[model samples]
Target: MRFASIGSGSRGNGTLVQDGDTCVLVDLGFTIRETEKRLARLELAASAITAILVTHEHIDHLNGVGPFARKYSLPVYMTPGTYNREKIGLMPALELINCHQSFAINGFTVVPVPVPHDAKEPCQYLISSGSSTFGILTDLGHITPHVAEQYSRCDGLLLECNHDPDMLAEGPYPYPLKVRVGGDHGHLSNSQAAGLLSQIELSRLQHLIIAHISEENNSIEIVRKEILATLGEWQGYLTIADQGTGFGWITLN
Candidate 1:
């Protein structure tokens, strides 16, 4: 299986995953034209995507999902609550998903895990095929036991280290907004993400992509340093997903 991201941050987020003949896109925060351009950068065409899986109803995550899905005639999957708030005219095909249930589409098994986030119905995804498992954990305010357990064994993990607590505290965001970001239903701090990595099985974890970083409150250097310190002696591939242009394809064999 192989996966890549167009970009990942508060401004926008989109991830492309492919296994054999099945190609799926998770989240769409860019405009249709922008998404096409990003896809081209990765040598992909928009029409190749078979489905779109939405994480929540947040504009940064759903902004382009409906438009792109409808344009491409791709099936979209999301929670019922999320569907309620979405503009139905945007998506050509829509599928309501249960947060705790597992569904199969185009030969890939998708398991949605509920998350603590300030959204109508937010969830993270765990995608698996015959050979590999990929986990996408972003937009969550705090890590739940269920989430940690489900994501522990993934072969490739895209984790959210939204911001550095110290930096966030001193950043320009107003009092309430800052509190919300650092709260239980906000976003994960760098330390929190690093700490979670320590508990997971790193032996089989081939790739660790730190994603959803706050441009105003965090830096790649800070996140890397924290993760390295938390990793102790374990050695693994690490990359940070950027907002302008996210890292390229990561293939797990």
Candidate 2:
């Protein structure tokens, strides 16, 4: 299995996961044209996507999902709550997923784990193909015990390190917005993301992609320092997903 990010930041987000002939997109935050252009950077076309799985109704995650899926005539899966909350129009193929259930799409097995985000029925995805498992967790304020357990044994993880607490506290997001971003239903701080490493099994983990970074409130250097400090001697391929270029594909054998 291999995965790549189309983009990752407060502006937009999208990830592509594939195994052999099966390819899926998780969250498409850009417009249809922009998404196609970004996919071109990864040497992929819209028709190559087998399906689209959405994490929530947030614009940065759901904006392009409907248009892209509709254009490609691809199936889209999301929780009912997410579907209802978003004005995504009509889709050619729509599948309502239960957050607590694991479902199969094409050749991939997808497990949706509920997360405590501001969105109604927000959840992250754990995708598995053959012996490889790739987990994506983002937009949550804190990691729940259930989340910790679910993501404990992933082969590759795209974890969110949204902001630096100090920077967020002092940055220019206004007081209420800052409180919301740092609140229990907002985003995860760098320290909070680093703290999760202690609860997961990273022995067999291969790739760790830092995602959903706040351009205004966080820096690559700060996130790297905190995560590296938390990881200590652990040896894993670490990559940061950028807002413009995102990151290249990393294969897991």
Candidate 3:
């Protein structure tokens, strides 16, 4: 299995997970043209996407899902709550997923684990092809036991390091916005993300890609230092998913 991030930030977010000929996109947040361009950067065409799995109704994750799915004739999967709340118009093939169940598309097995984001029926994904598992956990406030258990054994992990607690406390966002971000239903801080690593089985982890970093409220150095502190001397391929050039494809054997 192999995976690449299309982008990751407050502006937009998308990820490409591939196994052989099957490629799936998770949350297309850019416009149709922009998504096409980003895909082109990865040497992929929109038609190459076998399916789109939506996490929530936030614009940063749902903006281009409707148009892109319609244009490419791709199948889309999401919880009923997310579909009803977003009102994503019409789709060529729409599949309503239960957040508590596991489903298969092409060669990938997808496990939708519900998360505590402030959206209607939010969930992150754990995808696997045979024995290799790739898990993506982002846009959630606190990590629940179920989430920790589900993501503990991934071969590759795209974990969200959304902010630094001290930075977010004194950052530019207004008080209420700050409270929301730091609340139980908002994004995770560097410490919170690191805390999750304690629950994860590092021996099985081959790739650790830090994602959804806030450009304004956090810096690369801070996030890197925080995560490194938690990881200690564990040697694995560590990377950061950028907003502009989201990192190249990473293959897990």
Candidate 4:
């Protein structure tokens, strides 16, 4: 299995996961043209995607899903609560998923784990192909015990290290907006993400991708410090998914 991201940040987000002949997109936030260009950078054609799995209804994650799916004639899967029929317009193929259940999409087994985000029915994904498990975890505020347990044995993980508490506290956002962002239902702070890294089985992980960073409230230096502080001597590969152009494909063997 291999996974790559087109972009990841507050402005937009999209990730591509491929296993054999099946390639799926977790979310598409860029415009149709932007998505196409980004895919080309990954040496992929837009038509190569077999489906799209939406996590929530946030514009940064849902903006291009509708148009992209319609253009490519791809199947889309998401929890009913996350689906906005009117907002998304018409779909070529729609599959309503139960957040609590696991479903098969060709060669992959997708497990939708519900997360604590302010969106209607947000959920991250754990995709398994044979013995290789790759997890796409982002947008959640805090790590739940259930989430921790479910992600305990991932081979590759794309984790959200959204912001630094100190930076967020002093940033330009208004008080209420700051409160909401730092709240229990908002994005995870750098320390919170480090806390999750510590709790998981770090030995089994091959790739640790820091994702969903806030452009204004966080920086590469801050996230680096937290990750280094938590990783200690662990020698797994580490890369930050960029908002402009996300990192290249990392395969799990």
Candidate 5:
């Protein structure tokens, strides 16, 4: 299996995961044109994607989902609440996913895990094909036991390190906004993300991509240093997803 990110930040987010003949997109936060450009950067085309899995109804994650799906005649899977809350322009194929249910579309298996976020029935995803699994956990405030269990055995993970508490506390965001971001239902701090990493079994983990960083309150240097320190003795490749370039494809066994 192989995975790559289109972009990761408050501005927008998208990830492409492929196994054998099946390719899927998790989130569509850019316009059709921009998505095309990003895909080209990775040597991928719109027609290659088999489906789009939406995590929530946030604008950054929903901006181009409907249009892109319609344009490509691709299927979109999300919770009923998220579907109802989203005002996507139009869609040709849409499927409402039930939280906690395991389903397969095309040749991939999807496990939707519920998350606590300020959205209508938001959920993160764990995708598997053959013997490999990829865990994508972002835009959630806290990690529940269920989440920890589901993600503990993944071969590759795209974890969110949205901000640093100290930077956010002193950064330019307003007081309430700061509180919300630092609260239990906003975003995960660098420490929180690192803490989750410590709990996962790292022996089989080949790559770790830190994603969805806040451009206004966090810097790559800050997150890199913090996460590197947290690694301690674990041997794994680490990469950061940028708002513009995201990251290149990394394959797992």
Candidate 6:
């Protein structure tokens, strides 16, 4: 099993997870043209993707889903609320997923864990192929007990470290937007990400990718200092998935 990212931030977000011949896209935030370009960087073509799984209706995650799916004639899976909340035009193949259920997509087993975000039916994914499990969690406010337990074991994880509380509180966003971001239904802060790291089984985690960072409210340096402080002497790889070029493909053997 292996995974790579197209981009990770408020502007756009997409992740690719593959096992053998089956390659699935978690979300599509870029235009069809941009998605193709980004895929080319990873030596991939859009037609090679097996399916697309959507987490929510947020523009940064749903923008390119319809166009890309229609162009490629690919199957799309998402919760019904997410599909109904947004008019993404006509989808050639759409599958409605239950947030609490685990389903199969080709060789991968996808577990959709519901998250507390400001969306209709937002959920993150835990994808497993063979013995390697990869978890992707983002755009959620706080970590629930269910979330903690579900993500405790993974070979690779893409965890959201969206902002620093101090920076967000003093940033240029409007008062309501700041409150929304720092609120219970908003993105996770760096400290919160570290706290979750402290709870999970870090020994089994081979790679940890920090994702969905706020361009206006957070910096890589700040997140590094904070997360590294929590990581301490942990031996796993720590990678930051930036808005521009999300990290390259990392394999799980």
TM-score of each: 0.98, 0.99, 0.99, 0.98, 0.97, 0.99
lDDT of each residue in 225-244, candidate 4, tens digit only: 98989999887899999999
* Cand. 4 TM to true fold: 0.98
* Residues forming the 10-long window of minimal summed lDDT in candidate 5: 86-95
The candidate that achieves the highest lDDT relative to the unseen native structure: 6
Q: Which 10-residue window of candidate 1 scores lowest in summed lDDT?
A: 85-94
Give candidate 1's error at residue 193 in angstroms: 0.5
lDDT scores of the candidates, listed in order? 0.91, 0.93, 0.94, 0.93, 0.91, 0.94
Candidate 6 stretches with Cα past 4 Å from truth are: none
Clashes of 1: 0
Q: Would you list the clashing residue pairs of candidate 1?
A: none
Clashes of 4: 0
lDDT of 6 by residue, 74-180 (tens): 99999999999999988889999999999999899999999999998899999999999999999999999999999999999999999998999888999999999
Q: Against the hidden true structure, what lDDT does model 5 obtain?
A: 0.91
User: Model 1 TM-score?
Assistant: 0.98
Tens-digit lDDT track of model 1 for 201-221: 999898999999999999888
Give the alpha carbon lDDT tens digit for every residue of 1-253 in model 3: 9999889988999999999889999998999999988989999877778999999999999999999999999999999999999779999999999999999997899999999999989999999999999999999999999999999999999999999988998899999989989899999999999999987899999999999999878999999998999998787989999988788999998
**10 residues in a row with least lDDT, candidate 3:** 40-49
TM-score of 2: 0.99
Model 3 scores a TM of 0.99
